[model samples]
Target: MSRRPITEYAVLSDCRSAALVSSDGSVDWLCFPHFDSPAIFGRLLGDEAGYWSIRPDGETSRTRRYAGPTMVLETTYRTRNGMVTVTDGLIMGAGNRGHDLGAGAPGALVRRIHCTEGAVRVAVIFAPRPEYGLIEPVLREVPGGLLIRGGA
Candidate 1:
């Protein structure tokens, strides 16, 4: 895929860290743990860097907007078969403080998808190269999702 204009990306944040997700449903930039940390997904700089994408199986017309005044993002895709909405955000803890300050905060990236009409096939790919493509992390399938670990 060709590089998209930077203006085409949407911001998702939790007051501690942020992610830049493109209109096509690809998270091109993400700094984890803290705002100053290195990016795990840096495809915005190079193709080999890394990326996480969840999108429809084929072409789709898309419209996106921040869910409200917050950093939560809602992107709706209309495919030939059906329509789906994907909500992305860096999880926030209670009291609305930085995620790290909350007792239950896990510093997690959340992506919620819902199918509103018809039926559509979705695909998800997560390829993380931590420390800005310096270290390729190991991914192990867990009970719920894959666990990523590497680097220091």
Candidate 2:
């Protein structure tokens, strides 16, 4: 299948694994628990089939960058009326910094967003896709968050 060229995306991880946050504010690609483990989010392959995303209420222009040499991503969205900025990154352990991707204890992907300029409405959607397109797994909302079952 053909894939849409991602206009922009950012990488965030807690050392064990990484997730890609799209310019639209969606976490399109992510591998949970371990980097080589089954992907918990895979919407990057199809429409609304995998992962999570965040975007403005409507169409808008966006710009993104890494915060210094860190894995923290700073994305700015510009609309007809105002602009907003989103900061996304994985919370690392003490004394750890940069895009090491392999220097922290297991942790969840942390996405922190802030409005830098003006007021802009944002939309958030979370849909996890596991096992690519082969298996249709079951979704369960656990205590902490959602979990997927099945897939070998």
Candidate 3:
């Protein structure tokens, strides 16, 4: 993947937490639960930092934008073989507009990708390092994705 400027990253949030996703579909930075909370992904700082990425296996061109006025991000990737779309967002709890993530509001990050055209191979890498890359989280495969834990 080609390196992109920090300005090319898109901001996604539920008003509780924020994630910076690169144009190439890499989640380079994310602060969970709250803006000041420990980071789960911080590759934006350096290669040794953590990151989670999902992208087309081969070469691809992409376009992205927020869905309406919401924090939901939609990225579409078009490859020689086909096209795919990825949607990312942080889900807010009932009755919560997420005005304050520091208020102990609960939420979850969600990523969904779907093939829209022909066929395309997809790639996914999930690495979680907490505490600003000071901790390498243990990962276990769950029925759907993974369970990650580290540091206090």
Candidate 4:
């Protein structure tokens, strides 16, 4: 079988945790509770697995930025009729300091989207992948997000 296209994806990790944000503005890779912990989302490896993605609906051009001297990223999409921007960042610890506590806290990925220029349609897709590639996974919808269970 042919492999899926490697769509553009931005990586966000705090040395401990990591995630991949797709060109379509979807977050396809994420491990929760802890970086080494089992992945809560792993759709990047396949279509049926992974986590949620927030993106503008319809055809659109994209752009991105980071919040100055930081690892934060801002992604912007401009469609024929409108524009939408997403601000992505990792939550900082106390005193406006980075999470330099040597792998202490679990990481959080934040995505904030805003409409600019004109109204645009946005979509959110949540697909959770518990396994990497060894075993098929089960996706369960939790109160706030999803739960992926399975794999070797």
Candidate 5:
């Protein structure tokens, strides 16, 4: 992946820490729990650092918007054959609102993709480099999702 200017990324925050998501649907940077915590994904600094992405299978134009009054982001991809939308956010704690939104953040990231028109193939990639990209964890398929393990 080519280096993207910082301006090309969207910011998702729990009000304490934030993530940088590229226009191509890649989450190139994120740190959990606190703003100064070690990054869980850090492709923003190097290609092999890590990244998570959700996009259409083929060439497509993209557009994005933030859900009203929230840090939630919705990115839409339009392909020659169909269209799909992916939503991304750093989940705030339940009941968090207004000045307290994220005051109790559960420290989780969420991504949801849906096809609203025609049939569009989707591509998903998940590569996590824990501890500032130093630990390349072992990944295994599980019943609900992939399990990532490594590091002491």
Candidate 6:
């Protein structure tokens, strides 16, 4: 994974934690559970520092913004074949509202993407290097999603 300019990154926060998403739909830096926690996706620090990427396979033009008044980011990628919108958010507490928005944080990140027009081949990469790339965890597949183990 390569590092993008800080200006090209979007900040996604759930009050308790934050993640930085690059212009190419890659999460280059993410520290969960707490603000001071070790990075779960730390590519910004080094080449092998792990990352998660989701994007259109070929050349694409990108645009992104924070959805409404929340910290959730909506990034749109337009390829020659089609356009897709990717929404990313560091999930906050259930039912939490203003003044108590992050009262019961869950420390989870959610990324959702959908085609807005036409169709394009998608590219996806998931690599988790916890603790600033010091821990190479084992990834297992379960019924609903993937599981990460063998890390402290």
- The top-ranked prediction according to TM-score is 3
Relative to the true structure, candidate 4 reaches a TM of 0.72
Query: Estimated TM-score per prediction?
Result: 0.87, 0.72, 0.88, 0.72, 0.85, 0.87
Count of clashes in candidate 4: 5
Whole-model Cα lDDT per candidate? Answer: 0.86, 0.72, 0.84, 0.69, 0.85, 0.84
How many backbone clashes does every candidate have? 0, 5, 0, 5, 0, 0
**TM-score of candidate 3 versus the correct structure, residues matched by position:** 0.88
lDDT of 4: 0.69
Query: What TM-score does candidate 2 reach?
Result: 0.72
> Which candidate comes out best when scored by lDDT?
1
lDDT for 59 in candidate 5 is: 93
**Which portions of model 2 miss their true places by more than 4 Å?**
93-104, 130-152
Clashing pairs in 5: none
Q: What would the per-residue lDDT of candidate 1 be over residues 1-152, giving only the tens digit for each residue?
A: 33789898998877777899998999999988678988999899897789999999989999998886888899999999999999998886556564336455666788889999999999998889888888889889977667777686
lDDT of 2: 0.72
Better of 1 and 3 by lDDT: 1
Q: Which is the better candidate, 1 or 6, if ranked by lDDT?
A: 1
Model 2 over residues 1-152: C-alpha lDDT tens digits?
A: 22656555667867677888876688778777677977777777765457667777888998888888888888888988688887877665566555654554546666666776678888887666676545677878878665667576
Candidate 4's error at 1, in angstroms?
10
True-structure Cα RMSD, model 6 = 2.3
Q: Residues 25-111, candidate 5, lDDT per residue (tens digit)?
A: 999998876789888788987877788988998799989999999889999999998888999999777787668765655657889
